[model samples]
Target: MFFSKQWITGAGLALALLGGTPAWSADPAATTTAAPVAAAAAAAPAAAASAPASLDARVQDLKGDVIRLNRDLLVLEEELLFPASTQVALFVSMDVGKLFELDSVQIKLDDKLVTNYLYTPLEVQALHRGGVQRIYLGNLKAGKHEIVAFFTGKGPHERDYKRGTTIKFDKSTEPKYIELRIKDSQAKLQPEFEVKVWQ
Candidate 1:
């Protein structure tokens, strides 16, 4: 009921390759004529050669169809699971993170732990390079909600540092987006944590 695109494509190609071309016969009288028989014999090899090419084209067409189908399925699944009316997404980003070496993040929604994500060095570098990572996506009722985030890492002077930030926002029928940002404070020579709610 839920076969992946890769599995379906592989199985379809295997079936096509195994189903060889059917055999055809010419009438005995037709074969008796030298000119007609010679023509038919010459065309036979050409047809055989073209058969594989035709099958290959068909397999390529099927692959395209599978790719489109997979994309559609993912869109449908996301809509069903997290409708726009109640969807809430949280993202994490860093800006000029020279004072912090991020290690992990913990998020709490309405005082309940929602996510605790540990970051690898590559992921930290990506954030430093302006890549925004979606840390959570789920459904929340249309009302006021609170979110708390804790950022743990090494701060200026290579000292262990942890900071917590919180935000209270109201959600409407439209989707809600919240971004947790980490930035270096040049004036204070430390890392700053902020929560930005996007309208």
Candidate 2:
């Protein structure tokens, strides 16, 4: 009778405990709350974004430099195909109407006096025949040079004129002809000239 009474008491206690348990245990409300919290936690990493702004700027700058370098290389290749020559031509055209050749015509190449003439009106006429006057510069060195022409006008005074041109000498070439076109004879202003060196 005692053993049977003990077993009945234990069974009754187990039933009572099961009946009085918290409602959340079976309703799943706690689990639902925990699911949303876990989702929010998982999304938190997205909020911490990465910009790398400095790295982006550096990449852009490098890209620009590469483009510029490519253009420069193309130009260099074209120029290399027809590299400059050692020989060049020096040409000058002047107005004979306003300032008739009065006398001595002098020109200097690179500070070295090349031509000096004595004044004579007849010398101008002689130049047409190449019998009296010819501006001659023999086998000049390759590189930059300066040309200064001096002439005496109708007046008894001396006047100075300048024409600056750059000369480039290449690896294996003789001088090609150069030209100097005179501008504004009446004004006697500075003149612009171009020299081409060919190989």
Candidate 3:
């Protein structure tokens, strides 16, 4: 059990009140007066100790409420800005990337530049380890659209290489997801870029 300063003071006061008179010299009047004072003094410490515990619990509960509220706000904002019916997302990933070291990526939607991303060493290593990165998210109309992606990297033999790939697909009432993939071609000893539209 932990004792705060207030608790220790109250305990010492109660002890003083109860032990002030020796047993052999006890007087009825002194005993009666000291009993109530000692009791009240001891109760003060108990009440003081419980107050802080209750306050700490309320603080923890309030922190949990704030986190939940922030998450709800984020979801509401996303729905208002990019509804599912018109939403389009593009992702980048790598597979067996021994032949390439990715440095940057550029994406175009219908010939308009959408996103240009530069990768840090850690991010490139993550993709090489099978991690996928979402590079673009926006609203698109319900019609045919063309997406182009350009990947720049160091290819086999430590030479600079750049490649572009394109795909055309129709969007309806559902969200569209497209993946730009970089893969090592073992047979050709080179890196290949491909685009895939997910249904």
Against the true structure, what is each candidate's TM-score? 0.75, 0.34, 0.79
Candidate achieving higher TM-score, 2 or 3: 3
Which model is ahead, 2 or 3, in terms of lDDT? 3
Scored by CA lDDT, what does every candidate get? 0.90, 0.51, 0.91
lDDT of 2 at 82: 34
Clashes (candidate 1): 0
* Candidate 3 lDDT by residue in tens digits, 31-135: 788789989999999999999999999999999999999999999998999999999999999998899999999999999999999999999989988999999
lDDT of candidate model 3 versus the reference:
0.91
Which ranking of candidates, highest TM-score first? 3, 1, 2
Candidate 2 per-residue lDDT over residues 1-199, each given as its tens digit:
3568677667766755775323324447755876788899988766544346666889999999999999999878745653445433344444333334344555676777776657455655544334423355355456555666655444313344333344433323544454433333446532333333322
Supply the TM-score for candidate 3. Answer: 0.79
User: lDDT score, residue 27, model 2?
Assistant: 46
Please give the lDDT score for candidate 2.
0.51
Candidate 3 regions exceeding 4 Å error are 1-33, 39-54
